[model samples]
Target: MVGERKQEKDVKREKVRGAQDKGRKTERKGQKSKRTECADFTDKPRIFPAEVIAGKPVDISCTFDTTCNGTAPVLTWDTPTDVSGSISNTVTQHGVTLTYTSVLTLTASLKHHGQTLTCRVRYPSVSSERTLILTVQYAPQDLSMTSLDMINASLINIIEGNSTVIICSVKSFPASNLTWRHLNVPMNRTSSNNELWLVIPHVTSRDTGDYECVAENEHGAVEGSITITVEHAPRNLSMTSLDMINASWINIIEGNSTVIICSVESFPVSNLTWRHLNVTMNRTRSNNELWLVIPHVTSRDTGDYECVAENEHGAVEGSITITVELIICCVESFPASNLTWRHLNVSMNRTCSSNELWLVIPHVTSRDTGDYVCVAENEHGAVEGSITIIVEHTPQNLSMTSIDMINASWINIIEGNPTVIICSVKSFPVSNLMWQHLNVPMNRTSSNNELWLVIPHVTSRDTGDYECVAENEHGAVEGSITITVEHAPRNLSMTFLDMINSSSVNIIEGNSAVIICSVASFPASNLTWRHLNVTMNRTSSNNELWLVIPHVTSSDTGDYECAAENDHGAVEWSITITVECRDSSEWTAGLLTAGIMLNLFVAGILTFVYVRKSKTATEERVAEISDIELSPSPLTVKHQGKQNMLLTDPRNTTREGETSAPQGSL
Candidate 1:
């Protein structure tokens, strides 16, 4: 037993040794794997995007390959100044390998642009680091304006007609776009990187306002403004002569005091002055007003005058001219001179001299007409006045004239139209005129020896002889004209076979019918006949139209019309021709027979219905009586202690005080 036990121990010891060797081999493989595991950055820093927008959050991740060694990995990030960021790490396992992702979150700023961000990963056995260059995209900032020639100020003032340039600038990453604006409206400008130029070749009041410099980028926009003021000299200058009667021209009478005023419109107050004949005149100034006064004007003062208004910027001038008139004397004449007048080498008749030389003419007559001269000699000069007289006579001949009426003695006019009659007379002097119609005075208008008689809306009552009479103190004459009023045909009448009062005519079939249309009018009108609005055979005589229908038939049964037309209008008279049928008697007889038959049929039906109803009622009464039982006691009853009787037959019932039929007999 001792030998068997020792052998068992040796066998167990050998098995133990084999187990230990296997355990050692497994541990060695694991150690070798742990030693070979290394963390390496898989994503290169150059792969990251180069640009990022300021104030926007960005996420960047660095990936690494490593092995799991029972310890957590550490991730660290180094960020640029003014850039805030957070780092996180994620580990993913594939078999025995681990992928480490380190994510860095950052809010970028302009200060962070062109800076480096580093991400480092530390593992139990290995470590990795990555560096990335960041380019931060930012909007424009620090917008400002600089004046090229003028003073640099938020509010600037410039002289009118002067050139100026303004530069707009901004500071930004990625180069900002710049523009210029005037009073919130965009201005045309020349632009470059981060700057815009606004060039004004000539500055005027229109350019005075707030000017803005606007800078913009994909991120945002900013603006700054400056005020501009423009100063200008006086403009639209005007000069006025206060003593002149006309505003367009200066004309002052001799010995009259005159004043010239200067006016101007300008941004700044201006000084005003007056000059005459290119020489400065003595003037007075009050505020913007300057006046030059001449106490007594003369011919020497009749010259060009200029008013000048000037300011620091520039000056403007306005000019005017003055004129003077000399007075002259007048000559008079009486008893109407027989001589012609002469003034300034011109011969004047009495009428012309009366106006030109202020010469008086009294009792002017042709026999006293001649050249008359009145001479006045003075030391300075000699002047003469002469005149010739003429006389006017009264009317002599009178005549009538008209355009529409060929003959002045007579005229024909349509109703509701105007008529003009002119009575002309040959006379030197104008005459009083009047119109006489039907021996009664009428109102008329007179001009120069002519009498005008105008009649508007002429009617039948206005037709008469019109006499025009023209008279002056010396003579009188008269003329006459006749006016006739024409109107449309009226009071149209239709006659049948000389029956004048008839309006409509009826003719028998196969007989001739003559229809006459007569109308009342001053002048005979053209007449025609129409059947159903179509022209038919007609004969016209005077104001009458005759429509004759020969052998009238049923086909001719329709309305016929007679029409009459004159210069004024037209009139129509209508009549109905109802042709009598040839079979009238037969038609009447047939109608009577039909009516009789229809009445008889209706009567027979009514009689049969009445008889049937009577029979039915009789049978019903009999049946009802049969249903009643008869009493043997005479069918009697007592009422109010008097004998009252009941009849077996209902028709036999008795009224009060009436005898009843015997019951047995009923």
Candidate 2:
């Protein structure tokens, strides 16, 4: 029994040892399982509000579920170099599980934005980490403007009709809202991240103003501004007068003041100037208006004036005409020699001069109207004064004078001949005179008081009542005269009565033979018959005239002339009358035949002479040719030597083989 007790004690001892070893192995396995478990925070491993604004205070907390080990867990935070914060930890237990919390307090800024913030939990076995990406929301800062086109300047300048854009740049945590404005009015814009563009298309002078670009976000708003200057040329330029009826022209008396204004309608105010005679004049400019003041105007100041406006774009000008009128002082005078007056360097008669130094004309005539100079002479020197005189009068005694001195109201002229008419008038002031035919105005060569009207070729159409009209400032007067154009007689002829077959009258001795004279004339011309250079009594009515002889006799056989005369002139026709005796009729026929035979005989003799002369010329030419061929060579040489000697010495001489011929020999 003692031995059995000892073995049992030993087995018990082995059993105790085995149980202790198993307990130690279970402890090691529990420690390994705890290490493998996830140590993430109970809350999400991220920041509370996924975003954070720069320069703003924020709270970041992380919680981790720890294993039941009875040991405290450490919490740590990792942050950027620009960020500083305090981290605190709190531990809680639930049954066998332990929870650890870490809290970080810091002010977030732009530097911390878009960075990761980490929170870590440290335990005996392993550590747990939580990461938070910082989304810092901040206002726009460092706002500036950048030009996108040709307008790359602080102050934007663009010509009319050009386009440009300016961008506003800024720095912000988030994309900020952008806007563009001009003169407090919203402008069209295009926006991008951190930049806004203000677009100006087809810029003009009307678009020139201050412009603003604004960038805004939930945090704050910032703006940038630029000045836009739209340049344009001068336009709608004009000149006007304050002292005249017409805007473009003015007439002012000498020594009077006048004002001329120049205006321009343009942007970026144009410079205005006044010019005269192509030279710049003194002027004052205010805004778009320029003023040229003439304090004391003179005759020399009368001319064309120009108003010019200029800008960077171009120049424009307008013109006005100024006329300076002469200031006249009136003077009256009566006939007297004490005062001497000269007009245009000519002395005035006593009838025009007066004792009064100032001239006072009673009846102002054109001759008295001029620039008159008065002279008062002394032994020392001569003093002179000048004045301009103007006279006014009415026309009087308008008259028409023709080339023929006829009645004032009636005249007679011939057709197809040049006719001249003078129209004259008498008036105190010279009048304008004109000539008219049948109440129609006629063209004339005119002088001061007379008008000469010439008709180169007068026709029947030119025959009418002519009028001379004189017109003046007061009234007009006219005188009329009737003109009758006469044509000479035409187609004048004389016929014999009682002779049907012949132009000559044949009747027995002491018997009666009648003759008739006819003609065509404008005015009935007085007709008469002249027998043997002596005029005979005749009767005439209208264009017809009759001349009668009671008895036919030898005296009537002589030449008879039918004559017609009037105011135009005279025309005549002649005819011969034959008084035949019945007993001597045969003798008359024989005498006529004998006269015809004598004429034929004379013609035959002239023809015979012409033929004989032609035949004689032909015979002479043949004889001359024959003589030349038959002449001897020695004789020819002798003749040639004799001719040469005669030419050399004027005296006639003979050669060795020749003899002298008679003076008439050929």
Candidate 3:
């Protein structure tokens, strides 16, 4: 029973706690549903419009709505986001669709680029956001600029003018406008002949300045500038004379600005300057004309003055002079004179002296007439003059009054014979005339009044002037006569009388010889000969002369001659002969000497042999004596008284057998 009561109490308490927990769980479920169902458009995908409404600012936005609850919801739209233009956007409530109205504004600025319109919508249970592009549809980055330069203009200076052109070009995408300005001031620009141009006719100093070209486009803008200068021709050139009192002057002159007034019918104008004497004057162009003002005047400046002009076509020059002095006085007509003519030997009155001024000429001839001047002078620079004096003349009359052929002229009896010429003439006084047969000189014949000439063998060497001079108290005169020589035939001869047979030789060595050549000539001739490459000596001799040879040799026999030459011609005669020597044994003199020597030797040997043999034979023989005995008895003495008997006088002739002879004592 106790267990039953505990279970019942626990049941009642648990029922009450379960009811409270169920209520709390239901409230938590409701709070979680509300939180999850709230609408947030940022979390969902939205579509933006392709093309924006042109010319206006339309802003795109996102808004939230929690009332709608379906797949496609109805919506409401409001104003745009961009403030540049009026907002005109419309939204339809068929699920979700939005469209913008157009307020077109074509005059848009660069800031309108990429502008867009916004369309915000409200739905019953859902929300959404979208944007539509609002583009001005303009050209971008359209502006550009370029430039060119002008250089090296030599023709501009030579042409004496100024011309120019601009080369800066401008390009833009939207066709920008270009304009030119000078020093920041707008310049006149025009379109003529389908091209933009800036023409400045008659350029002046004021035109030289900086220039600018401004280009503008819808996308951007650009500007550029250049410097320009204008030039003009030379001017104000003039010239003047330094010494006008001395008659010197020029029209135009200047140094710098003065233009050399030159005609420019062609392209280039000539340079201008001044010239005087042998030097050129330095000057420059100033205003209009070339100006030349010399500081001083001198004699050196008194030469030809010239103006020179030149161009590319050609050049020319003109000249004049500056005379420094003027003539003061001149005169004419003075003294009268008589004229006459005469013949002098050398020159026709080379000089006239005061003594020769007497005008008394002798033996009138035609050589002395010429124009003579006579001047007279006095105080004021003295002026007195006369005309020419004329002298008329004729040949003097002369003849041979007496002629002596033996004394002056003759004919030759033989060749080269001399002669004399003698002739006399009668004029105011007796005059002698000389003569010459031919051209050869004639020795002077006489002096003073009478002339004489002697000639010897007149030949071609004597063809010249033969003069006869006559003199007296009044004056002197000369008569000239030329003598031409006649051609005289000349003759000359050379003779070789005995040239060959005079040669001599020796038949033995070491002998003397001679060879003689006789050459004689009428007009004198020369003789020369050679032997063994040596010239043989020649001595002038008569016909029977001799040539001596000191020694002779075998080589002496060769071509030998004596060449004789004269005025006619020359001739050589020669002789060649060889000499043979005989043997020594064949000579009589050598044989006689040998024979005499042999005879003498043989006679000496024979005599010596005979004497020696005789001696030897005698040595070989023995001596023998005869034997006879005599017995002596007494000595017989015969005294002086014995004239008697002593036998028949022994002084007489003895008989064959004698009786007794005297005995001697033994």
Best by TM-score: 2
lDDT of each: 0.61, 0.62, 0.37
Q: Model 1 residue 333 lDDT?
A: 46
> Which of 1 and 3 is the better model by lDDT?
1
Tens digit of per-residue lDDT, candidate 1, span 591-644: 565456445644664565467547534422211011111111111111111122
Error of 3 at 186 (Å): 11
Candidate 3 residue-wise lDDT, 489-518, digit = tens: 122122222233444222233344444444
For residue 78, what is the lDDT in candidate 3? 32
- Candidate 2 lDDT score relative to the true structure: 0.62
Candidate 2 Cα misplacement greater than 4 A, ranges: 1-50, 68-71, 123-128, 148-154, 189-193, 244-246, 265-272, 282-289, 327-666
TM-score of 2: 0.42
lDDT of 2 by residue, 504-598 (tens): 55644555445667666556578888887888866554444556565566767767788877667678887767777645666566455434543
Ranking by TM-score: 2, 1, 3
Better-scoring candidate (TM-score), 2 or 3: 2
Alpha-carbon TM-score of each model against the true structure: 0.39, 0.42, 0.22
